[model samples]
Target: MINITFKVTVGLLATFGCYILFQNKLIANNVFAGQTEEINQNNNEVSEQTNGESEIDVVNFNRPISPNPVHVPGWYFVPGFITQPMKEYNVHLKNDFQITAKVGLNNTASSGFGGNYFSWFVSSDGVNWDKVSQNKHSRDTIDTSVLTDSSDTEGVRYYQAYSEVQPQVFNKPIYSEIATVHFIKGDVNATEIKVNTSKDYLVSNPNFDQYISASAITQPKGATGRVIWSSSDTNLATVDPYTGKITANPNRKTGTVKINAEIINPRYMRNSNVFGYKELQVKKMLEIDGETNFQNTVLFRLNPDFDLSKSKIEWFQKLDNQVHKFTNISDQIISKEIKLQDNNSEIYAVITPLDIDDKPLPNNATESNHVKIQVKDMPPGANRNVHIRQSLSNISIYGNSENIGVHQLLKHKITFNDDSETYGYNDDNVDGNLRIPISINETNIKIESIPSGYVPDYRIENDGLHQDIIFENFPIKRHFGFDLIVSTRVDKIIDSSFDYNPVYKYRTLFNTDETVIGKPVHAEFSTNTIEINPKDINFGEHSKLEKDDVNREQDLDNEKFVDIRDKRIKYSPISLFVSSSGFQRKGAPVRNVPITLANYDENGIEISPKGNYFEVASSMNNSPLKSVFWNRKQGLKLKFNKLNFPDGDYHTTLYWTLEDSINSQTK
Candidate 1:
């Protein structure tokens, strides 16, 4: 009986084992279908969550379906539905443009059990679904991928997930509600960003306001991201963070400064170090100050607040729109005596800033306004108020007072043919001074007249063309008028042979060869003649007298032959006269005029007995003639001597010569 029982039990156990094996194979073959159905249902639920718009879920229908396997008797049973299903899910995006979906579950620990898994789905549209990836167990989160469709246009990607689960009572897959996300379809390429408004800007005020701008030529026009502004030298300038406006720093020195702008977009320029940069140069203005109109000396200076040590300055003169550069200049204030031309004009200053190394800074040169130079008065000789006086006077004949001294006077009037006239009494009130503010070398006056007597005597004070005259002292008065006197005194005897034809010439002392020949002052006097009436030398009656010393050693006899003698006699003095009309006045002094006489017996040969030949009317030395005295007269004394001789008519001619040697040693 035991044997029979064992056979039957063993056969039954074998049959049961085979049966379990076949069922396991069947579950394994059918599990996939159930999981697929659960996934479809999950997708439908996800579609419901997405506003009831169902998406065409494409799956790998060719993939093998699987079934759940039964456990053996006495095997431990662990519940696959330990955690609840996920209800809602959301898709999140990061800065790197990474998208991920998180499913909301009642139980946070929602790992799938049995032959189940979790899958993520993505689609360009709700109609066509594309598989992203599948996980072995359903989880709370899953990563996703967004790609470009056949067209290059980027579309909003619709996303969904499926959680294949095995509940204690059912075996299927469930899907969470769809979480849609819009992603960029193509690769991120940084737009070429450039800093606009990059140029040198002029700063008028100490605080200057400038702006910087940026541009991108890529996919999005306005979404280039945050813009940042920076300055290469903060001491020179500063820029605003939010606004790209640039401003000069406080107490900023004038120079060239650089500014930069950048973009902070990761999607676009991810690998680029520099986004957009530009060199914005800052410029400051220069100015000049001080007086514009000037007479002799002027002071001009530059306005401060600029680095003059590292700068260059130039001065220019502008006349009739023409520019002329001044070779001599000072960087700062300039005080100099200026000479203005006859025309009207102006001057200007140009300043240029330089770099540290003394190079000209770019776009930093400036020019100043024109300063005018003008004169205030008119020039000399603008009118005709000057003239020369012409008159003759002083004539008298001297005779023995016992003879009633006869006198004759003749007044000669002279007329100047040229405009070289003298200042008349009518010109006393007119102004003849030079009014122009310039230097004058010389001026002239001409006097003319006719006379018949002694030449006028005159002397000039300060040498020739006196340099003591300058613009500082003007309106020089020239006195050419004078008084004349001519008289013959009986007390003096005139030499009949005296000659007065001496010429006084004017010459510049600087060069003896150079003479003021043709100028206003030239030769001055004419010839003069002296006449004397014949007079007899009388010694009462002739007397005879004896000289007792013939041969005193032989016989001192009073009876010796006697000799007769008469004393010599002196004649009355005669005088010569001179008038003002014959005088010549050089604006300067004249040298000593000499008088010489040559005695002859009507022959040109000089005779002997120099003392008896002739006597001079006057002697001269190195002294100059006085100008104040208009007339001069001098007398010559003649004496007679008698010797024992026979004579009928003894006549001798005296030649007289006068010379005017102007000073040649003037300094």
Candidate 2:
């Protein structure tokens, strides 16, 4: 058969071989052959075993399983079981029984069936097992494309997958661990201080030597350095440069003091520092009462002990509404008084320190108080009289009685004198006094006499005289009346005298009975007649005619006058003898009758020659009539009839004439 058969068979075998070849070709074409087949088959056997183990009663087995069923060891059942090497089996078996495991082909018995593998199982009881994966395994390299599904089974221990299972090994499990980190902190330091001053000082220049300390903690990277100060900062104090101490000027203004401190780093951080303050002190000055009165020693003063060396002082006064420098008074004492003029009305004073230009010193200046003084009447007695006088003898007139007719004329005179003794008089007599009087005295007086046949029958009328006198006369055909007047003390009289006579010649005849007749007849016959020897007469100082002279002149001449003329005779017849008739009556005386013889011769008788004849004739008397009379006298008198004569001059005349009968003519 081999040959025939080989032929046939061979042919057939060839055909079969061909067929086998074709079939091999077909099988090779249709399925993996050889190692692929063996791989497949090993894979199928692993699947079967795994399936069989999955079907095994895990309750009946005695091994324990993990509580988390979905979690499983990743490196498990990586090789076929029956074909696994003993070491691999032992390794897998030991890991399955223990809690921790390492798996590889050299340690497990089934490792040669492929590489190495381990079992992953599910169990409800510790002794029973249900295969989750079997004998096909991979290493620990993660597969990004593989996913786990626990949905179909409950109480699943592990989620797992198989590696390409020609031989098997498994991967190991991983665990987590713990870690730690670190940081740091910061700090700060700060401080403050205070100081005091004395009352005597005006300003404090605290030197840097006197210091007040300050301290505090600060932030680590915070500000740290020397502090600076100003009047503006917030939380720090100012320090003196010389003393290195902190103090305020007493005159320092009240307000906030700002301070600042900063660390000198490339980066700067500023810390604000400040403090607030006020000054403590008592201030003073002055006012004056009466500045004008403070002359000489007056003064004002501050406290006596005040030190002028450390301070300056000056003074001034206000005058004329302006301030004037007191050049006179300047000293350390705060008080002074100005020496004022006596007439000054107002003044004021003020004081200040020399060092300070604007500040006034305390209790330094004042004003003073004023006074006023008043001004006292002038004498009444001292004056002398004037006197005047007049006289009255400077005016008068006189005349004879006959040629001036029976009227005669007289005269008057006047004069004046003064008797007052005083220059002026206060009395009625014009005597001595301051007051004088008015005087009236006689200045003149005058007189006029009336004619012989006319009388001035005068009487005193408004008489200013103590007495009055008057003169009167009749018409005697020849004489006028005479009067006399005088003024003296009450009854004194003054006398004057004058004589009077007729200017015509005339004669008068009177009978024995003193009858005036025409004329005397015979020259030898007796008659009465008067004779005036002078035609006129002046009776010098003798005022009266003697009675003997008047009678002697009248008896010298006396005469009688008669008329004898014609006679006739006739014859008578009766013849009687008449011769003897008267014889008896005159017998003795008539004895001689001589005429008888003449008669006898009657017719023719011539015989009478020796005898004379008888005859008759006329006669006259021739002599001047003489008379004497007073005319006027001197004195004061009044004429009531002539009172209206206006106190001036007047005159009148009176006359008488005689006629002769025998001659039929006037004489």
Query: How many steric clashes between backbone atoms does each model show?
Result: 25, 144
The prediction achieving the highest lDDT against the true structure is 1
Q: How would you encode candidate 2's per-residue C-alpha lDDT over 1-667 as one tens digit per residue?
A: 0000000000000000000000011011111110000011111122111101123222222221111111101111222111111000001111121111222221222334543223344334433445544222322222111111122232223222222332223323211000000001111222221212212111111111111211111222122222222223211234432111233332322234422222121123344332222232211112222333323333433323233332234454443345556566545333444332222222222322221233333432222111110000000000111221112121111221111111122221111112322222111221111110101111122333232222234332224432222222211121122321212111111111112111111111100011111111110100111111211111222112221111111211221111111110111111001111111113233332211111112222223212221111112232122222111221111112212212222211111111122221111
The ten-residue window of minimal lDDT in model 2 covers 7-16
- The count of residue-pair clashes in candidate 2 stands at 144
Model 2, runs deviating above 4 Å = 1-188, 195-225, 231-307, 310-314, 320-330, 336-667
Q: Which runs of model 1 end up more than 4 angstroms from their true locations?
A: 1-188, 202-204, 207-223, 267-270, 287-667
RMSD to the true structure for each prediction, in A, is 43.3, 81.5
| lDDT of candidate 1 over 243-353, digit per residue (tens) | 344555534354666556554554445565335555654443333243333235566555443335545678776666577887878465666454324135566566555
| CA lDDT of every candidate | 0.31, 0.20
TM-score of predicted structure 2: 0.14
Clashes of 1: 25
